[model samples]
Target chain A: MGLFSRLIAKVKGESGSQISASDWQELERALIESDLGVKGVSEIIELAKKERGEDIESSLTSALSSWLSTNSRQLASNSDRLTTVMVVGVNGTGKTTSTAKLASLLNNDGAKVVLAAADTFRAAATEQLQTWGARLNLEVVAGPQNGDPASVAFNGAAAAKESNASYLIVDTAGRLHTKSDLMDELGKVRRVIEKLTPVDEVLLVVDATTGQNGINQAKIFAESVSVTGLILTKLDGSAKGGIALAIERETKIPIKFIGTGEGAGDFAAFDATTYLQGLFQA
Target chain B: MFESLSNKFAGAFSALRNKGRLKSGDLSDIANEIKLALLDSDVAISVAEAFVKQIEDRSLAVLDDVNKSTNPSQAIFNIVNEELTAILGGSARRIRLAKNPPTVILLTGLQGAGKTSLAGKLAKWLKDQGNTPILIASDLQRPNAVTQLQVVGESVGVPVFAPEPGNGVGDPIRVAKDGIKFAKDKLHNIVIVDTAGRLGIDQELMQQARDIRDAVNPDEVLYVVDAMVGQDAVRTAQAFLDGVGFDAVVLTKLDGDARGGAALSITQITGKPIMFAATGEKVSDFDLFYPDRLASRILGLGDIQTLAETAKSAMDAETTAKFEKKFIEGADFTLDDFLSQLEAMKKMGSMTKLLGMIPGANSGAIKKQLEQFDDNELIKTQSIVQSMTPIERNDPKVLNGSRRARIAKGSGRAVSDVNSLVDRFQAAQKMMRQMRTGKGGMQMPPGMQMPPGMAAPAISKPVQPPKKKSRSGNPAKRALES
Candidate 1:
């Protein structure tokens, strides 16, 4: 059963008149299981209990949707100047794939785009991006193996400016946000891009299945490189991506896109209403 | 980000502290709190509820006999700990090998689950254990998946069987079946078939996994799960169990500060043992999973055994002998020795990770203290030691105020920072002296202390497990020793 249906069943127990303690506990569990985090769950539960007289579903929806931003989930870009977009996250969170998808996305939108393979740490990371660039038929700028990532970002920015591209999506190496040295490298990548032109959007690609640590990842990435938006990837799985709500609630950085599958066409803009409704759907 | 579930568990039990007798209401409250704790750690709702129910039943039984134990909370604690350990698979399980010549091991999981990297780690691990293992790149779904596997295989010095480059051009089932045949032909005793990461609900992909499974009839199918996975763990684990039927589980990205409640959920739902854990990004960061150790970690009691084992593994033979002699002769642990220890500890992994393994290190003041500590702290220490003269490093006693200031200036750190490093070193030196006489009871790394109630397992001296000899004839016992 969907989480909402299960929660409704929990509420409609026996006489179906009043919500019992066990029902509240069930609601809490549902939220916790969705990676809402202990603190986030408790806050929602407290707000939920305070509005017990009203429709539970509507009350919960309002509470959750309030945490999410209704702002435009579109990728920020500059029409006159080059728009530099940096795709970054920890290892294997689909940063490269999402970068390819985003590049294809912008390219289909009738905008000139260039790709940069700034991920030099992981073997075949550049090749991964290069392959995507080849499929998309877009130019890809990559650095030497194990070379400094910032220099690659620098070259990518140069290429984008030279080509007069509308967007330059720099795919950075996946590094754990907790690693200080690696985070420093990410900051340098940003600084290098900003040195040439202002970075329009720094999207942190998060896996849909990430737990409470998602909040920390968002916070650290935002702090390190001023992550402008979030791209929730791997949503093709059964995971509800509820952590995105918690992250948006905490960081106020809206999720720009959702990756439903491995294919480039599976990318879509985030819709808060659809997401909130989907959360409870069976 | 990953709050120690043990801390929450302790909070639950603390309510019943100092009570002469236990009531049913008390047990219920504790049970409720425990359910929340488990849920907070990303344990599936049904699994957490069932686990709490077990705790409630066990606690009520103990309540029936009031005089069974002096401490009711301790009794409950033991019950929860034992139950958790039992559910996590009470003993470590080895990878089951086939009776035939080439043992086919199929790796399956969702995308970004670290299957490609783990295949290499598994191959290298098998190679180290005197087995010829070859990796087969059958993950033809994701872009550059084949290249990733080939790169990982090359790094581990294992041959990869990739007849066709991935990117949806080749049939994975054919590759897997052909890879098994190739392994047999090449006389490779082990064939690790790396498959595409797919969602459990995708029928086509699920059928693909079944096709590969039926084609090669792998001896062991390992479900590679990301340790940071949340509530969907139950559904995904159940799907894989029913759809593909894995023999065991392997947890990846364990180095992240996630509670790893998915471990509990998967094992409980699928009845599979988690055989290995990929702790860090490095291929060598992989290790055999220990249920008792993970159980303790889940309960917020630090994983001291793993930490000690890591320390033992990180230390070279010469360093071990040197420390052993110095420890026995009651010699001072100089700055030079301290510097070397610091460097070796760096090889052990992150300082935050090391401290995180200590009991109560995740809580209040200790956690605050941990914020000041990171890998950078080790780099600073290395630079500080390098700034010192040979004499000063050999004998810290010769270092005067001017020399300390000069060293701090040379290291580009404040004089107070230098002083703190020296103070920490001296404290470590004193602790080493106390340890030699068996008086260093339950102390942690310098500036950290074990919380009052949590008694660290008595590691009187550095546990130096003999790396060369196999004292135990039993394979499992020997595996633990190693």
Candidate 2:
């Protein structure tokens, strides 16, 4: 059978009238087959059964869709003020890329954005952020790659304040979340930013392909710094988007943005309604 | 086998093996091995350090208790397993899907992690289990991803809903919304959306994905990854989790020569279960991942469960039924089946990786030989198969001189190319027949080795016939022959 036919079959499988009670067992199997972790499938089934009656399939679909939409919406809709977003994650998590992307998104929304290249460890990191700044035409305050990241954060906050930018996106050095010294450096950067201006948001940039390991990084980062939101990058390559549901279940962190691709315009804000609609579209 | 890891383990065991007592030095060696393995496998360095430290501390205190056991290897294995299990959590955790009918699954990953492929694979798996799935081609930036996805969708017989090019990545959310409404009108059940990928992690991409998440309101967000990336995959996963918190992880390319150290450590680091594993390129090459099997693979104790899971994940019920039917009918297995089998072998990862999986198949020369026959060659062979006419493909005997010329023209090759293909097919068929008849299986032809490298040979060697000599004619005949 072809891929499209199989997909159609899956969509048809949800038809309540076409399937018998024995076929319902296949629903769990279907979920597992779709890579929706076993626990996740059971959760969905239990939730669906509880709301069961007439039109169980539709009910289950809507229930699952709504549950996700509701949770994600609650997380992303956290107030409309300055909404300072500080990007954090280990090296190579695309922190720099995410920072630039966030700036572009905010700028596109008509908000003046300032980016702080506080990731002063890797030589290429600063240059990369600078290149992004040039492409997006956004203001960037960067320290030398080997310089103190906290200094960059302080300067960036000052620049944001002077420029009257609504959102100050700070790109911190990519350090292992489990490293105490690195976490301390991150804390210091946060302190510097707070001293310059109130630190409103802490966003952790995670590579979606790492599966649960990404979540583990989140846990450690959250411990090191009180992370407020998540930006899941590389959604385009990740086959198991289930990690988002898993992360939310484990950490209750709201995913603010998802990086679908490398393009500056590829980032999108998390929307619940469309997500629900997309889930059952098949 | 844990070829490299075995040496490390050997070093650790040797220290503890003869000492009749466990020392800090032995514990340190074991800890070092864990750290090195984790790092090599691409576990975040910090995570590796902390993990090794914890193991060291625990082992130091429990050495006396563990040393009392007669089997030192077992004791070490138990300890390592315990440490690994502790770090990874006791068991796997599952994602939290919505109670509604269309449970949304959002995929995220790095550019080369195969997220697009996973989306199709997942959709196919869902269809097999009797669910209706709509595949959304939301990856708007990458070159030809939508088309690739459409091809995948078509192959799986699933309908794909994609926004027009330049419509923006988030446009798919709106399209998906409309698709859902359409499905509702038509009563479709599930939708799987394929998103974009970046060369590296960037905030703009995350925001776009987040925007899609908001727009679509997906139930489960999965982080897809390439397991062969080792520690890099783990670090990247952590970054994504921090940015766009996902529900579970789907590890792809498990068939590669990855020690699977990242998979084992990722769960412990993120406190999330590896929901699924992708072992091959085929849509069916996905399995509902189990932690124990992964642990066993990491420890170099062959994971039969994982192997079975890989087969089950890759082969759909329909394909399996077809195979069963063919077996019952005692039908002649054709070249097409052989080609598919070869393709499947390629999907199991690099030749070196497959060899590593088999017991005692690890040898330097074998690894090099396996490396030679890579995926590129498989693709070329597939193209060659595609080039043949239906009759020519089904029956090699049908290709006479005229047919060979026609096929060569159609396939954009020389006549000799067609003849060689026919010969190879015939040879393969004969070998298959022999094997089926319980005769000796196919052996390597003299002086011919499986070509290494996926690229086609730069120069084709002309076919040579066996030379004959008349020994009875003595010196004159020998001179004449010379």
Candidate 3:
């Protein structure tokens, strides 16, 4: 057995005994070894220690579950009526692909949806979004690749208002989150969309394989615009998916969805309980 | 790695290196090389085209730099690497959370992309970070999806709030809203609403995800994707991002054999930092994404962190200490030690990544082949060793006809297989003995040069003609020639 598995087994074998500080330390060590990150391990350890005198396994599990539920609840309540979501991220991070995927997912759930390709950076980005729009047979507003992204977003929102579309998804240029000018451009787009229609959401498209760096990028993008949620993609690679823990711990942002494959149907909503179960299982 | 793409990269690099310098003719060749590599690796066509244009422009501007460099090949390599990295975005991103309690997270994805699995993974990740999370099973279409969420919830010991399974589709979203309220009342900080996944992207599904976004006002909406889907994954992610305005991406199944081209291209296409990765089915297998580590792995420079982990798992301190002591004393260089080292190597995932880790292992086809050998075969060999009696294992001479038959039966293999194993082991032992004695009898095997920085080459090289492609389009020929 690997060192991590061995440690987990050692801890699990002693589940019935009174938990000691050392045992908690071992568990924390195991978590760190598993790539849970320092912040996550310490947070879990502190919560586990609060129930030191109780059933160790149950307490640890409950503490973890409660912690996850608490974090997710914070994001859940922030969603309000006419919540507009402005999706922005760097190019090739599945920005355009994710836009179509998200549009299909929302449309399936019976929401009035409209898509706008405001990614005026690439010549074919608008066409790519248009292709998905055709497949879904949904209305799409698009501009030339080198045209103004903010203008496209404004026009798209105006179309949404005209059609009384319940949800308007504005696809923006894929720019570096660290680029102040690009980030400022995102702010302009968000403001323009809100002027046309109430902007309810600003979602950052993040690749799951980026680890802690993904979290750092999200922070910068969040600062630039009113980023309300996270959309993590490409789950079927070599990346360990540890950024999920780091992002929540450091940024306290609720992860809304996960993309497991290239299919349009590969997305699913985030569930803390289910996530914990998958995390703890061997 | 995906076999086809790996071959393409190898072929492209070889061709580029052979040309020695950048020229207008080299532009088409480079573009074609890159196009084939990206397409074979499953990068979206549009993205690939844009990348090629950018590379072409950059390459033209850096012609002087390439011409002036001591090694033109290395210079080109740097240019390609730099451009690829830039297109993928130079850094990662974090999420935005509201200051208030009860932040809602709307999760969306297609069916069979491990959306449910990711939901569980995300929940555990959040909980470990001190956030109180509640799971909302809003996927009312798929049969047993609710139960699946509950099963995951029960496993994590977290409460799963969902409408009764028999309820209609819309009911789940309503319950999700109510669950969010309940979680808030209970002092929970986050509510993750796990939505249903469809077989394909359609208007209905997009509406559902958007409806939930409208109803819950989630702080974040994450789109889940499977990385193995390659270019398809990138395309799907874009579609979903447009529909729901998801905040970030959660990639799953990173441990699979996917070339991970999608991961590289996705960031460039979306301008988003990959937030997290699901390496294995186990919850602990999740990790935050790192572009540099991924780039290193892709470039065939083995990931050090993964390598360290493998070593820690496979090598005990006592065994390492013994090996170290023997190396220092110059007395531990035995055939037995070599065999044991081979055994330890079997525990790592593959020979390819390991070989790539060693100095000078990246030069030739033979080295690549050795690295890519099947781990299952190694396991079979390991089992064969286990089946042998201690005497037969330690002393190969003890394995006569009767013993060989017995061993074959124990290992459930043909006697021929057993004999072959013994023969290979004996040949290896003989080679080691010859090396230790420092006799003129010792000579390195063909294609076994000890890398440039290591010990001096022990054998004269053979002059072989450059192999041409066979009519069959066999990649082995191309690889061997390169």
Q: Which 10-residue window in model 1 chain B sums to the lowest lDDT?
A: B452-461
Model 2 / residue B19 / CA error / Å: 5.5
lDDT of 3 at A179: 45
Error of 3 at B131 (Å): 9.0
Candidate 1 wrong stretches, greater than 4 Å: A1-63, B64-68, B327-333, B386-392, B396-482
Top model by lDDT, which number? 1
Model 3 C-alpha lDDT per residue in residues A1-282, reported as the tens digit of each score? 533345455565354344566767666654543334445667777776675534455556666655441344322212234446688764445677777888888889777778988987643467667767877878889986478999998888888778777778888876645345567788888887877667767777776444334555668887888577777665543233445655665677667777766557887776666555444431
Clashes of 2: 140
lDDT tens string, model 3, B77-163?
666667666665565565566799787878777654667767777788788788888898887764456766776776676778876
True lDDT of residue A180, candidate 1? 74
**lDDT, model 1:** 0.82
Docking class of 2: incorrect
TM-score of 3: 0.49
